[model samples]
Target: MEKLYEVFPCSETQKVLLATYTLKDEARRDQKVSEFQELKQGRMSVAEYEAKFTELARFAPHIVDTDYKKARKFEGGLDLEVFDRVGVQKLPTYVEVLDRSLMAEATLAAMKQGKAPATTTTEWRGKRSGFGFKKGRSFVSKKQNTRTSNSSSQSSGSIPVCSDCGKRHRGVCYRVSGACFRCGQPGHVVKDCPP
Candidate 1:
């Protein structure tokens, strides 16, 4: 009470009015809950979502009490891709969700930068051996493969691996020579790389 009085620096009547002013009115509480329900983690960072959640929770703590409920709520607002990646995760608490969400955001960012997102490739039938050329028409140069074989023998096994994408292949790596020098990724030149 003394600390409050000292910090506020107000008379008794003023303090009473201030206290009433800071009181959580029912109308404001309902509004906050509505805002919380509408919250989405679209373009904002996870930190921003968490901060907003914290603010709104002050008005409606009941809505986010349990770990399951809190985690679900947090997942609901995530960006489409991030939400898809982390949605199936069974987080135990709001804090766990926050931490995992940050990790998911980082992964999404890395994926945007051209790093392949870790995903299970169950359907291998539809997948191609490497970028460019149909099956047997791949462009591995015989001279280049023979000369580079001893020097760059990353794959000692029977399955030949491409230097660019690291995928196994039978013939020359079509992406090896013509890869974009600027981005260092296969399949496109520097001028064709995304802006």
Candidate 2:
């Protein structure tokens, strides 16, 4: 009777506790922790990547113990384009970084579709310049004239004509159809084409 009790434990709680301890797999937990460390956004969208990140994060609590650490860790796994856009904002929280990454993904998608305004590129550059020009100043006038000339040359009949295909389109001709600017191929871009 004493030997059986020693083998099986005495009370129900003790038996359950012993079984739970016996089932715990330290190697499996370590594998999860390693997976979290190697996680990347890759081809996944921001929401999908976020779901995976949350799922894995639980296995590695010490790495992301603080809000800032968690935010940085999340940012580090973003796709290159999204990471570049979100990194420039220097957001302080995980939520802010995630939101900005989503926004950046949308903006990139719009740009790829040629639905984004041409001014968006110039406006972003202007904001980053950190030099404010007064209205009617020589510098401002020059900048405005350049923008006007560029837009006027690019616009025709409400739809912008694509320089690549010489066709009237709402968005970029090459990007909208995913064609190479150089060889006009769909699978690759101009940079990878032979001259």
Candidate 3:
């Protein structure tokens, strides 16, 4: 049998005692002893931790997943060690940075009040809209994704438009503008842009 402390060393003494008491209460309240027997035996599945849960999007908005896919191809950029707690097999690009690693532990614990671990095809990212930069980083390319189109880079044109605000300016937008030699501003040449 696994030691209680080994199972949950982080729980406070009082909390652990209460959890055990609660489990006993649940056992008595279940009204289905045969169902409980399945759990006691190996027929039931065990719960998983946060890292694997988040990596695979198995858990709820338990944690945010960053666009690790946009990172560079370098080994340092493909850091998946952080998700080791849960056996999540995620592409290096699907990981997200979290403020607190332990937060997932709590979320998973609450969810696992005891359930089986099942493999799921989890889509951690949100659906696309017609706006905004495609993703957070540069590890992966859009050419490799669903929005695959020949990048604007391949199209030859005398000018470019700011993807944001759709303004017309030249010689670099004062802000994050996709400006070109034409129509990036209000009736003015970039050379004559008021200083």
Candidate 4:
């Protein structure tokens, strides 16, 4: 406030005209309009956004300026989803856009509370709750599966299975390439298995 007062330095004789009530009001209004242009909804509630809009609009009559620049500026401050839904191209007038945005906001609030909007055919209850993965489904590598099948047919009894990689105990397990535990060798495991 002191800085603003210092900015418009005028002699005491000229102060009466510059610091008049009307001039001060106009300056305040101009500041309000400037703030309105840079406004962003962010995490503000719909009511808070509307209140700010209304407060700023009262100060700036040009908020309904020609070519709808003011309207576009107002819409730009809204949430991206709301802006995309009821932008200048979509809505015919600023009034319509404002109305649609309010309605959309209400619908979104309803959805957050696990209630479907009036337009929704299916009931909304937040996100679907269930196990992350589907039941009766498991991964089986093709190479491992083929090798397991071959070993099952070749071996008379149960074939050895590694606890780590879950693959048949060949010369080298599928995952572990070197340092075979069986023979304690680098390149090979127990038997001279086929590549």
By TM-score, the best candidate is 2
For residue 158, give model 1's deviation from the true position in Å: 34
TM-score of each: 0.48, 0.53, 0.14, 0.45
Clashing pairs in 1: 41-77, 140-172
Cα lDDT computed for each candidate against the true fold: 0.64, 0.72, 0.34, 0.57
- Model 3 TM-score relative to the real fold: 0.14
Show the colliding residue pairs in model 4: none
Show where candidate 1 strays beyond 4 Å: 1-24, 116-195
Candidate 1 lDDT score relative to the true structure: 0.64
lDDT per residue for candidate 1 within 17-113, as digits (tens), equals 7667666465677888999988997778887888888888777778888878988888888888877767787766665566667667766775676
Query: Candidate 2 lDDT (Cα, whole model)?
Result: 0.72
Off by over 4 Å in 4: 1-26, 120-195
Task: Kindly provide the TM-score of model 2 when superposed on the true structure, using C-alpha atoms.
Answer: 0.53
After superposition, the stretches of candidate 3 with alpha carbons farther than 4 Å from their true spots are 1-83, 86-95, 99-107, 110-112, 116-119, 122-195
Q: Could you give the C-alpha RMSD of every candidate to the true structure, in order shown?
A: 15.4, 15.0, 20.8, 24.4
Q: How do all the candidates rank in terms of lDDT, highest first?
A: 2, 1, 4, 3
lDDT of candidate 4 at residue 82, scale 0 to 100: 71
Which is the better candidate, 1 or 2, if ranked by lDDT? 2
Worst 10 residues of 3 by lDDT: 70-79
